[model samples]
Target: SQQGEEDPQALSIQEGENATMNCSYKTSINNLQWYRQNSGRGLVHLILIRSNEREKHSGRLRVTLDTSKKSSSLLITASRAADTASYFCATDFKETSGSRLTFGEGTQLTVNP
Candidate 1:
């Protein structure tokens, strides 16, 4: 099993501003993924980048991975107040069947209007 840690713990920004979050892991992984969670709700997958890939983008979301550094980052462009939520990074260990993800603590994002 692998573990992940998120930095800055929390973030605050105004609507239309961009938000960035980072994650670090302790072990080799098959892939890394990012997810968003509204308060008291289930997590929604945002993006995934494989160990062989460096970066990926989806709509207003961008994700970057550095397998060598065992770290990853997520960027949200033109963030909105509706973007206020918790962001998490997860790792899928190569040793496992990749059925589960080891999640980071999470970054609490607050977007003010």
Candidate 2:
């Protein structure tokens, strides 16, 4: 359980709003990465932060890490309908089980116009 398991399996937002999701894991990690996936578009890397880092932001997205509690959070600001997609958190450890990422059930986000 070194990977992340997100809560709130789904979320809906109106255009120009914001969305937030939380993730919790069970073991130490080297780094964590967030990814987004749209209907037709493939999974895109949104951001990544190492275990030593506390917070990271990119564009309208912000991520925070709390290693002591083994948890993380992702926030999207000014969300647009076009932002409708699924967001996933992944972890990379110094010792991986063959470089494979364990994914959770995922949180589906939809931004309505």
Candidate 3:
């Protein structure tokens, strides 16, 4: 099963500051991915960290995964008002049918100007 949940369901931050979100999962996973969704918009893939990797980064985003703990964390540096959105962590695992992806409840981020 690919079940996960994010902490601090909601977060408030100011422009130019850094925002961090944590996610924890229940079962083993093949890889984990982070996504960003603007209000009424489709999800944007941020980064993907494989089970063998510990951390990865792209632009202003950094993702770290801990397979032993079944957890992950995402950090956004120099946040902007435009960065305000809902961030979700999705876990990917292999099943009999095929690979499955399950997303967490998500963390609502509000970046102030």
How would you encode candidate 1's per-residue C-alpha lDDT over 11-98 as one tens digit per residue? Answer: 9999999999999998888899999999989999999999999999999999999999999999999999999999999998665454
Candidate 2 displacement at residue 3 in angstroms: 3.4
Give model 1's TM-score versus the native structure. Answer: 0.94
Kindly give the stretch of ten consecutive residues in candidate 1 with the minimal lDDT sum. 93-102
CA lDDT of 9 in candidate 3?
A: 98
Per-residue lDDT tens digits of candidate 3, residues 11-101?
A: 9999999999999998888899999999999999889999999999999999999988899999999999999999999999678999978
**CA lDDT, every model vs. true structure:** 0.92, 0.86, 0.93
The number of clashing residue pairs in each candidate reads 0, 0, 0
Runs of candidate 3 with Cα error greater than 4 angstroms are none
Q: How close to the true structure is residue 31 of candidate 2, measured as C-alpha lDDT?
A: 78
Number of the predicted model whose TM-score against the real structure is largest: 3
Ranking, TM-score, top scorer first = 3, 1, 2
TM-score of each: 0.94, 0.90, 0.96
Candidate 2 segments whose C-alpha is farther than 4 A from its true place = 96-98
Candidate 3 clashing pairs, residues 3+ apart or interchain? none
